[model samples]
Target: MQFFPIFLRSEGARIVVSGGGETALAKLRLLLKTRARIAVHAAEADPKILDWQAEGRLSWVARPVEAADLDGARLVYAATDDAAEDARVAGLARAAGVLFNIVDNREDSAFITPAMVDRDPVVVAIGTEGAAPVLARKIKAGLEAWLPAGLGARVRAANAFRPEAEALPQGRARRGFWAAVFDGALDGRAPEPLDRLLEAHKAARPAVGEVLFVGAGPGDPDDLTMRARRALDRADVVIHDRLVPAPILELARREAEIVEAGKTGFGPSTPQEEINRLIVGRAAEGLVVVRLKAGDPSVFGRLDEEIEACEAAGIAWSVVPGLTAASAAAASLGQSLTRRGRNSDLRVLTGHDVNGLADHDWATLARPGAVAAIYMGKRAARFLQGRLMMHGAEAATPVSVVENAGRPEERILAATLGTLATEIASTELTGPAVILLGLAPRAAARSLPLLQEAAR
Candidate 1:
């Protein structure tokens, strides 16, 4: 970010503006909302400036700005509407060690004003680093419509009640109490008396932590569900898997503690029991824990075990579904997991399990037009190919292996069942990949001129 957004304490501070025309008037309109003491320096003043000066809203000097005038100023705005004059004033402000802004000149300005939604204590500032002022204003307009006009009053009431609310224990209890109060207030209903609310909060049982199994969605942040995003935002501890991408992990709060409990297939991995214990232990400490997994947790993720652990420990748990890798891979291939006239049922299978290469009903899976999305199938390609072929599956059946589905470095390797293992080996697939049995990229099929070529 070129300009970090901060709320400067403007109360009782000095702000200098070196213009008096429309540009200066535009800035003064917003400045008047602040508590800062505004001073305008211009040889000729606008009628509005004269009115404001007469009303004592601001001090206006009937002469050009000078270096001495910038002393003790917290901020200066060179809105002279003339490039040379604005630059000259900017130089003086810089020499005086005051932050200066050149109106409409972002490149030369030390600070740029943000579009704001004013709700008194509930002000929201929207900025684009001066890249898109129109977009910023549009966002401000939307927020202005969404936020309640009475929110400021509610905030004031909460501020007044804060001293009594602090009597509750800190951490989750205090936060929960405040959350309940604002949640009710935002519903537009008349607020309950603060004393009654405080007594009710005190009488309420202590808050207990819970676990949310959130799907991170195939290595893409955009694919994350709003429910999953909210879970991450409120998470106190995030236990994520290896396949969960960094971009998705970045959604967690900065104060959140991140723990990597990745389990790789047939490779070095953290024990499942240990992961379950970690989830239960963290939740037991009254912390909101998020067990973040890639893709749909119920699909291939060992979700049942973690839930069982939580149940045994009497810890509450919930699930937030995500877009699975199979769906993303199919989208990337321009194909569907199931088609009306082709496959009636879609099977989601794992490539390996505790015993070894996971065995499925090869008889049904070998049938013509059978469709399946096989996760963790990269290393088990040869085993899968041999089993399917042994069960009378067609050697020429189309198979596509999608590596890093929905990610920037995604790769789709198209081949027939006959060459599935060979193609996988040749590609040296190193990333998490899914195998789509009986499917090919639609683009690749369309490129073939002959019907027979396209069929293959």
Candidate 2:
């Protein structure tokens, strides 16, 4: 980010503004909201400035601003219309080692004022480094409308109990108490609940940690469920797989410890035992741990093993289902995994099993109307081709390979079973891919023109 958002302590601080017109008034209006001692220096002042001075709202210096004007100022704003004057004030403020902003001049300014949401102790600031003031204001307006009017009051009431909460010990006990309050365990909708929560929190014990197995969906962050998002938001640690997209992980709390437990098909992978141990270990430390898996964790994600591990360790755990690869692949192709007449049952098959090259009922799968979505099938393409062909399956049976389904870079390669292996071999595949058997693409497969091999 060009400008880092931070809240400065304005109470008892000194701030100086140099201008008499609307620009200065705008800056003063925001500054007045803070408890800072404000000083305005202008040769000619606006009537509002005079009114504010008479009301003891601010101090007005009836002269041009000089270097001395910013001697002890924590921040300075130069809103003068004259460019030279603004520059001079900026230079003086910088030389005095004060953070300053020159109105409409971001290049020379040390700070830019952000569109703010004033909810007292629950303030929110939105800024675009002075590049998009209108956008920032729009965002601020949206926030103002969405936030309840009594939010500030509720937050202040909670703040009053912070001292006692802090005394409870520095750990999850204190944090969980506040979390419970915000979660409406204390009825944050009203003020009386705050008093009750404070009294009850004093004797409350620390909450036990939990493990949540959350499905990240097929590379699309928007596909994530609300429950999964909340789990990520509250996660103290996240154990993620290789295929989970970065956007989905971005939903996790910034303070959350992200541990890569990525397992690649036919490649180097974290041992399942080690991953299980890691989850249990983190949860044992009273941390909310999330085992983030790509797509639906229940579908060939080795979820049962992890869940069993948690159960054996006496760790509480839950699951948040997500859109599986089959669904996403079908969506990308504008096709369906199961059709009313074509197929009554849908099967989710893995390309390989414990013995490698998963063995299934080839006769049934190769039946004329059969359909299946195959996961991790890219490497076992030849094996699948041979098996289906041997079982009296038609060489013309349609097949499609969806690479990185639901991602921006997703691609669909379609061909008959006769050329499925050849098409996949000639294509450059990246990211996790899933194969659809007995399902045709919405349009004809665009074949990758292959160069004919010269006779040996």
lDDT of 2 by residue, 177-246 (tens): 6776776422335444755666687777676788999999998888888998989998999999989878
**What clash count goes with each model?**
0, 0
Candidate 2 residue pairs in clash (backbone atoms < 3 Å): none
The most accurate candidate by lDDT is: 1
In candidate 1, which residue ranges exceed 4 Å CA deviation?
253-255, 389-396, 408-411, 426-430, 444-456
Best TM-score goes to which candidate?
1
